[model samples]
Target: MHREISELIEIGRLLHSRGWLPASGGNLSVRLEDERVLITASGSHKGHLTREDFVVVNLKGEVLEGSKKPSAETELHLLVYRVFPEVKSVLHVHSINSTLISRMAQEDIRLEGYELLKAFEGIKTHETSISVPVLENSQDMEELSKRIEKKLREEKVYGFLLRSHGLYTWGKSIREAYIRLEAFEFLFECELRLMPLA
Candidate 1:
């Protein structure tokens, strides 16, 4: 929908301004009805996206509209849609906290007893905990996607991190996805700062 596209553009600008998406280092997509998706194109500056910077693709990652090529990680977005039909938006961002904490984590980063944990859907109290999965990063999207798919089947998580790369989070809508992203960033920063004490 036009509104979703506009929201994505606005989110892109907001994320870029926060330094989460720098130099075209992130990607965003919204799942549409009929197994179609509207996604950002490769190599476009996230902060300066226009209507022309988007492409429509099917669940299979085939472009149905627009001239520009989809992001290299387009398959990853498609994988999320296939795995979670309820999810309407997926966001991938590169931030210092995410990048650092992901590398520091062995298999998954665990956050517990943080009031911010309530920012995630379903968690009503800070007594709960979440384990954000960390997958090894790779340039081969297919291979990476396969690995992620396997991990997701074993663990139902709101998000995951690509080792030394970035974070991937989704929600029922773009706004929810952005909220999760922000929450994850805040949690990551808190964890990172606490690492020295640990």
Candidate 2:
């Protein structure tokens, strides 16, 4: 348990250093062996996270440990863990590119013909394409979860955007998840730069 928390703390610091998490902009969580999630507490700055800055919550989003409240986006992380049993970590990153591209695209960001596409699972070549869904933002967590659930039911989601908000992704481990996060950020920046020429 301590090791898992330490890993999350390290990841939080790395993310903050990359400028993907500004202020209290993103959330990080790891699925424990017993299925409870160790997630960053609400409003805790990612750059300055401590062991106490994380809280444990069940799959239902109920707090089981720690003193602070979990992030408001807790349901989203729980949904990933529930829907995909293999996922061990879920990361929500609020980077400038994710925020901007989520707004620039109408509904989804279609990524194709990029070497970075290989960063996601099951992709070997740049010839293939995948569309990252972009949903309109809503403060109503339940409603937002429902909408996201609908997407999950229909699509092969590597990650998603909350229309001008941020990116949500999950992986079998924290390391894998962070790799995809970096890839997504790179693709988003490329797309933004090429938009004018399109």
Candidate 3:
């Protein structure tokens, strides 16, 4: 349990150093073996997260332990666990490339013919294509969650983005989740670099 908390803290520190989690702009969560989730608390800055900065919550988003409130984006994290039982960790980030690409893209950001596209699961080659559904940002997480569920059910998605917001990606572990996030960011950066700034 302590090791798991330390893993989250290390990832948070790494993300913060890369400027992907500026302030409290993002959230992190991992599912415990007993079906509870360890999540960053509300208003807790990922850059300086401690064990106390995290709280344990059930799949229903109710806090079962810890003194702090769960991340405001708690529902989103819970949704991933419910949807993908195999997934153990969730990582959301507010990086410049993901944010700008979300706005630049249409309804979904599609990537193809890139070697990094193989970074996502089940993809054996670059011949495949991936469309990351990008929905408009909403303060109402319930509504946004509903939209994501509908989209996820209709297709195979490694992750999604909130327009003008950020990216949400998950995996079987903290390492896998970070790998996917890093791949997505690199792909987005490549796309951005192809377009000249206004």
Q: On residues 1-198, what C-alpha lDDT tens digit does candidate 2 reach at each position?
A: 899888988999999999899999999999997889999999999999898999999999999999999999999999989889999999999999999999889768889999889999999999999989899999999999999988887878799999979999989999999998999999999999998844
Backbone clash pairs for candidate 2 read none
Relative to the unseen true structure, what is the C-alpha lDDT of residue 188 in candidate 1, on a scale of 0 to 100?
94
The pairs that clash in candidate 3 are none
lDDT of 1 by residue, 1-198 (tens): 899889999999999999999898989999988999999999989999999999999998899999999999999999999999999999999998899899888768889999998989899999989989999999998889999999888976999999989999999999999999999999999888888754
Stretches off by above 4 angstroms in model 3 are: 196-198
State the lDDT of candidate 3 residue by residue for 48-129, as single tens digits. 9899999999999989999998988899999989999999999999999999999888668788899888899999999989
lDDT of 2: 0.92
Looking at candidate 3, the ten consecutive residues that score lowest on lDDT are 103-112
Show the lowest summed lDDT stretch of 10 residues, model 1. 189-198
Give lDDT: candidate 2, residue 78.
Answer: 97
The reply for model 1, stretches above 4 Å from the true place, is: none
lDDT score of residue 94 within candidate 2: 93
Which residue window of length 10 is worst by lDDT in model 2?
Answer: 189-198
